[model samples]
Target: MASNPGPLTNWPWQKLGNVKYMVLSPFVANSLYSIMSKEERERDVTILYIYPFFLWRMLHSQLWISFARYQTSKTNHRIVVDKGIEFEQVDRERNWDDHIILSGIIGYIAVMYLPWAARMPMWRWDGLVLTILLHTGPVEFLYYWFHRALHHHFLYSRYHSHHHLSIVTEPITSVTHPFGEIIVYYMLFSIPILAMFCTGTASVSGIVGYITYIDFMNYMGHCNFELVPKWVFNNFPILKYFMYTPSFHSLHHTKFRTNYSLFMPLYDYIYGTMDMSSDKLYETSLKGRKETPDVVHLTHQTTLQSFYHLPPAIASLASKPYSPNWYMWMLWPIPYGFMFLTWVFGSTFTVERNVFDKLRMQTWVIPRFSFHYSSSRQKDAINGLIEKAILEAESEGVKVMSLGLLNQGEIFNGNGELYLQKHPKLKIRIVDGSSLAVAVILHSIPQEAKQVLLIGNLSKVSCAVSKDLCRRGIQVAVACKNDFYKLKLQLPTELCSNLIFSTSHTHKFWLVGDGGVQRDEAQRRALEGTHFIPCSQFPLAKARKDCIYYSTSAMIIPKALQNVYSCENWLPRRVMSAWRVAAIVHALEGWDAHECGDSMLDVEKVWLASLRHGFLPMVAP
Candidate 1:
C-alpha cells in the first residue's frame, strides 16, 4: 500500500485470495479442449501455449528467488550491506504473480478478438528482430521518462512509493507495483508485439521470447547482487551503454533520484540521470563482504512438511505458524523427495538472519529431524552434524550457540554437552536454555494454586520446574511412581516433603513433558477445566475440549527485534522458543559460562534477566 492510495490501485481479483487462479481456469480448459478436439493443423498453437508459458514464467521467477537467497547467504557478490527485509515487504510483494495472471487474460482476449493473433506462425526471425528494435528505440525511451514522472510527488505518494518501500531489493521486487501502474507498463511493452502483428511478422516464438527476455532482465537488475563480470564489459566496451547491472539499479532504489533507465542504461546516460557512484558500488559489491553473528540458534526440522514451511520455500506459509491439514497430505511426495535429498547430500544451512539492537543473530539448521535423533544408528550422524555446526559457529566468531527442538535431546547429545567434551577449549558458549524454559513454565503456574500434577517423562526442565515450585511451598504430585522416585532422588531432604506420589486425576493444573500415546491418554483422564502447560520443547495435542491447553515454553520477543517475518516452528509470529531467547539474553548480558550438561543457571536470575532485556512472557490463552 502507498502513503496516499489511488483508485484502481488494487488488482481486480485481489479479493479472490487463493482461488484467484480460477480466473485462468477458462483459458486453461479451452486450450486443453482445443488440443484434444481440433486437428493438428487447425489448432491455434499460440493459444494452446498460454497455460504452459504461464507455468514456465512462474518456475523461472522461483528459480531466481531461490538462487538469489542462496547466493546472498554466502559471502560473495552481495549488493545490499547488512540490511534486513521486514514482514511488511514480504506481505506487499506476496501478490507478484498477479501481473502474470493479467498477461494471461490479455493474451486470451487478443487471441479471441484479433484475427492475425489466432493464426501466428510457430517461428519468425523477422518478428524477433523487430521486437528488439522497437523495445530498444521506443519502449526503453518511453519507460525512462515515464519512470521519472512517477517520482513526482503526486504519483509517488499515491502509487510508485509502494515499489520503493523495499530499499533492500529482491528479484520479485521488480514486478511488485500498483495495479494501475502495471497496466500502463503493459501498454508500453505491448508496442513491440502490436507492431509485429501490424507488420505481419508476429510468431509464437517471437512473442514468448520477448516476454522471457523481459523477465530475465527484470530479475537480474533487481536481484541485489553484482553477477555481471567486469570482464564482459572490458572485452566489449560498447555493451555498457546498452546494458545495466544489478548495482546500477540498486543505486536508483537507495539514492531514489537517478538511474531511471529500463533494462538499457543508454537513456539514463544520455539524460544525465545515472548515479556517479554506480561504478564504485559495483566494484565493491563484486568483491563481497562477510557477516559474523553475535548469536547462533541451532535447530532442526520437526516434521516433513516443515521443509516447505521454511522461509525460502514459500513466503506466505512461512509467515504463519505451521499446523497439519488434510489438504497438506496431497503434497506428501514433495516432502519425501526433500527428505531423501537431505539424507543423501545435505549439510547445515542458514535458515534465517536477524538483528536485535545492533546485535547480529542467525538461525542455523541441522539437516536432521526428530525421528532421526530417536534412531540408534542415526545418533552419531545427528551428533556429528551438531558438532560441525558448533565448530563452524566458533570459527565465525559467534559468542553463543543455543540448541533448539530435539537438537538438545539428552539421549542424542546429552543436551548439547557432548560437543564440550569433544572440544573442551571451545570459545563459543553452549546453551540448552533449560534455565529459561524453567522460568517460563514456573511463571505460567497460577500463584493461588496449592498443588499441581507433574506427568509424562522427567527431563532437566521438568526437574527444574519441580524444584522451583517446591521452594514456593507448592505441593508437586508426580503421576508416575517411577518418575516420582527418579525426581525425588534429585531433590534435597528439605524439598522432598513438598513432593507427593499420586495417580489421582483431580488436579486442575498439569505440567506435561514428552510422551506420545500415553500423553494423550493422560489428557482424557484429567478433570474438566484442567490447564495443561507444556514444559517440553514440542507442544501437546488438545484431546479434551473441556480442558485448557497452553503453548510450549516460549516468549514474545521485544519490538526492537528486526526482520522477524517468519514464525519459529509451531511458535506464533514474534514468539520465540525459550531456548533460542536464552542464548540471545546470554549474548546481550555477556555471560561466559556454558548452560548445558547438568549445569544449571539460577532460575530466578535468568527469568529476571530475560524480563530486563524486554522479553515478555507469553500470556496464556
Candidate 2:
C-alpha cells in the first residue's frame, strides 16, 4: 500500500484471496465450450487462445523470478550489492498476476463485443511490424512522460511508491504496482493491439508476441543482475539508446530522479533525464564481486515437497512455514525428478543470505533429504556433501559454520565431529548448537513444574537437557528403561535421584525429541493442556488438539536481522533455529571454540550471549 491510499489501489478481487483466480472461470469455461461445440473453421481462434496465453504469461514471469533469485544469490553479475530482499517486498509482488486477470477481462470484452477482434487470423507479418512500430513511436513516448508524472509527489505517495517499495528489484517487482496504475498501463499498452484491430491487421500471434515482449523487457529491466552482454552495446552503440539495460533501470530506483524511460533509453536521452552513472554501474555489475560470509548455516531438505519451499522456488510459499498441502500431491512427479537430479549432480547450493550489523551470513543446503541420510548406501555421499560444504566455507574464509537438522545426526557425521577428526587443523569452527538447543529446551519448562516427562531417543541435546533438569531438582521421568539407563550413565551420582523410570504420561510438560510415531503415541497418552517442547531439531506432528505444541528449539531473531523473508523450514517467519542462531552468536561474540560431538558449551553462557546479541526466546502461544 502507498502512503496516502487512493481509489482502486487494491485489486478488485483482493478480498477473494487465493480463490481470486476463479474470476477467470467464466471466460475459460466459455472458451472451452466453444472449442468443443464448434469446428475449427467456425470457432474464434483468438478467443480460444486467451486462457492459455494467460497461463503462459504466468509461467514466463515465474521463470524470470526463479532465474533472477538464482542469479542474485550467486556472486556473479549481481547489480545490487549487499542489499537483501525482505518479506514485505515478496508480499507486495505476490499479486503480479493481477494484471493477467485484468487483461483477461478486457480481452473477453473485446472478443465478445468487438467485430474485428472476434475474427482474427493466427498470424500476420504486417501486424507484428505495426505493433513494434507503434510501441516504439507512440507507446514508448507516452509511457515515458506518464511514468515521470507518476513520480510526482502527489501521485507517488498515493500509488507509485508501492511499486518503488522494492529498491533492490526482483523480476515480479516490475509489475507490482497499484491497481489504478496497472489500469493506466494496460490502456497505454493496448494502443498497438487496438491499432491493429482498427486497421484490420490484428492477429493472434501479433497480440501474443507484443504482450510477451512487454513481459520479457519488464523482467529483464528489473532483475537485479546485469545479464545483457556488454559486447552487444559495444559493437552496436546505437542500440544503447534503443534499449535499457538492468543497470540502467537500477539507477532510476536508486537515484529516483532519472532514467524514466520504459524499456527504451531513447526518451531519457532526448529529454536529458538519463543518469550519468548508468554505464559505470553496468560495467561494475558485470565484473561482479565475491561475497564471503562470516557465518554459514548448513541445512538439508526435509520432506519431498520442501523443494518448492526453497527461496528460489515460490516467493509466497517460501515466506510461510512449510506444510504438506493437498495440491502438492498432484505435482508429485516433480519432487521425484528433483531427487533424481540431486542424485546425479548433487552439491551444496546457497539457499539464502543475510546481514547482521557487519556480520554477513548465508545458509547452504546439502543436496540431500532426511530419508537419504537414513540409507546406509547414501550415507557416504551425504557426508561427502557435508564435508565439501565445510571445506567450501573454510576456503571462503567463513569464521563459523553450524550444522543444522539431520546434518548433525550422530550416526551420520557424529554430530559434525567426523570432519574435525579428519581435518584437525581446520579453521572454520563447526557448531552443532547443542548448548543453545539445550538452553532453549530447559528455559521452556515452567518454573512451577516440579516434574516433566522426557520421551525420546538419547541424543546429545536430550541428554544435556535431562542432566540440567535433574540438577535443578526437577524429576525427569522416562518411559523407556533403555533411555533411563543411558541418562543415568551420563548424569553424576547426585543427579541420578532425579531421574526416575515411569510410564505415566499425565505430566503437564513433555520434553519430546522422539520420532514422529513415538511422539504421536506420547501425545495420545498425555493429558489435555500438556506442553510438548521439542529438544530435537525436528518438530513433532500435533496429534492432539488439546495438547500445546511448541516449535522446535528456536529463537525469534532480532528486528535488525535483514533479508529474513523465508521461514527456516517449519519455523515461523523471523524465527531462527537455535543451532543457526548459536553459530551467529558465536561469530558475533568472537567465540573461538567448537561445540560439536560429545563436547558441550556453557548453556547459560550461550543463552546469555544470544539474549545480549538480540535473539529472544520463542515463547509458545
Candidate 3:
C-alpha cells in the first residue's frame, strides 16, 4: 500500500521525475555494456586491447555532462543552471549521438562471430599507431565532403537538420540523430580499417584504438570544455593543427555551411570550407566572454527560475491590488463580444450588404480608431489622399513615394516599376528593420542633414531611427496620426527608454495616418499620453496586416506559431499567403476549421483559432 497519510497528500511530481532518472541511468549503462565484449570473452588482440577503449570513449562521451557545464560557465561568465540543452543546440546534434551509439554497438554485436571472410580483421601491433595517423586524415577528409553534401539543397531537410537541431550540443546529443547518418560516418571510417586489416596488411588493435581515439576526439570537441592547455593555443600558429576544439566546432554549428572538416583542418582548407575568423578560435578558454543569448539561458532565467531569482528589496510603490471578483470577469467579455461581432458580420450578413465587400481588393486603406470612419467610402477617400501624397512626392524630388508598409520590399517591388519610369535618378532605400539596416544608416549617415522623414511603427522603428537621426542637426517628420508621434515624444524616459521617441521634445508634427485604436495596454498608454495628434485630425489610411501560408499539416498550429515567430522571414511565401486568405474565406462560408485544413494557411488558422478558443470556454478543465 502507498504511504500517503491522507487524501490531501501525495508525492510531488518533481520527486518522481528525479527518481525516474536515477533508476534508469544504471539500467541503460548495464544494458549497453552487456552488448559489448568483455576482456575474457574477446578472441582477437584488437578486440582484447583496442576495442575496449573505443567502447569506453563512446560510453564516457555519452555520459559526460560536467565538461559542458564548465565550458558554459566560462563562456557566459556566470554559473549556468542547464548546459545540456545549450550543448545540444550548439554542437551535439540529437539524432547523431543515437546513431553512433546504436550502430556501433549493434554492428559490433551482430558481426562478432561472423566468419573471417565476413568479420573485420584485427589491426596488427606494428601498424596500429601508423594506421591511426594515416586513417585520421582520410576519415576527416571524407567527413568534410559528405558533411558538405548533407548541407546541399536536397539532403539538408532530412539529414543536416538532425545535426543542426541542437546548435549547442552535449555528450548524449553527440550521436543521437537518425540511424542512417550514423551509418554513413561508420561506413566512411570503417571501410579503410576493414580493407587494411582483412588482408592481414594492418593491425586490428590499432584500428580499434583509432576508432576509440576518433570517438573521444569528437566527444571532446563537442564538449565545449577548454581542457586543453593555454600553451597549446599560444604556441600553435593554427589551432586546427593541434586538434579541432569546441570553439572551432561551435562556429561550424552556428554558421552551418562553413568549416565542414572534422579531425584535421587540411581538408577544410583545401576544400574551401574552413572558417578563419571564428570568434571562439581566439580564446584560450571558454571563460570571460559575453553570454550567448540562446534558449538555454532564457529557459534558466524565465522558465525554470533556477538561474537566480532575487526578490526586489524595495517596498511596493503602489498600494492595493485588484480584487478577484465577478465584475473583473466583465473584462473577459469584451473579446468574446468582438469575436461574436466578427462571426456575425462574417456569416450572417449577405454579400451585397456585407461591409467588407465595399472595400477594394488588393488595396491598402488606413484603419480608423472608431466605427464612424469605418465606412468603405471613408476608406476609399483615405486611399485617395495617400495617392495624392504619392503624386505630390512623385511630382517633386521625392519621386519614389509610398503610403503603406514600405518595409516589405514586395509591396515596393510590385509598384516600384511605375516610379522607376517616372524618376530614374531617384534611389529610394527602404528601411525594413532598425536592428539590421537603420543601425547601419545611423552610424553611416552624414551629420549635416537638416530634416529627416520618419514613417511607420513609431513605437518601434520610426521612433528608434528619429532619435539617432536627430543628433545630426536633423528634424524628424513622422507620417502618423499627429498625436501618436507627438505623444511618443512626450512620453517619460523610463516608459520609452531605449526608444527614439523618448528623446523627442516636440509635438508640432503633421497628421498623416488615421488615429490608432487603443486595442491593448500598449495602445492605451499611447492614447493617454499627450504626444498623439487628435484622432479626428489624424491623416493617412494604410493596412497594417499581412498574410501567411502554412504549407504543412493543419495539425501543427503551435508549431506554425513558433515557425511564424522563429523563422528567418517574417512574411510567408507567396503561395502560402494566397492559401491563407483562401482558407479564411472558406472558413467564413461555413467550412469547419478542420475542413479548411488542406493547405499550410489552413493549419495556421486552425492553430490560431484553437489558441483563441482556449480562452473562450466558459468552464475550466
TM-score of each: 0.96, 0.97, 0.37
By lDDT rank, best first, the candidates go 2, 1, 3
Residue range 54-88, candidate 3, lDDT tens digits: 45654565345434443343344222212124211
What is the overall TM-score of model 1 with all chains considered together?
0.96
Candidate 1 per-residue lDDT, tens place, 17-99, comes to 98898999887787678778989888777777777888899989877876776666553687864566777788899999999
lDDT of 2 at 406: 92
Residue-wise lDDT of candidate 2 within 104-124, one digit each (tens)? 888887897789888888899
| lDDT: worst 10-residue window of model 1 | 67-76
Ranking by TM-score: 2, 1, 3
Q: For candidate 1, what is the lDDT? A: 0.88
Model 3 misplaced stretches (Cα beyond 4 Å): 1-58, 73-97, 104-124, 199-205, 236-239, 279-281, 284-287, 290-621
In angstroms, the error of model 1 at 236 is 2.3
How much is the lDDT of residue 379 in candidate 3?
Answer: 44
- Candidate 2 clashing pairs? none
Instruction: Please say which candidate is ahead in TM-score: 1 or 3.
Output: 1
Off by over 4 Å in 2: 81-83, 516-519
Model 1 lDDT at residue 42: 82
How accurate locally is residue 159 in candidate 2, as Cα lDDT from 0 to 100? 97
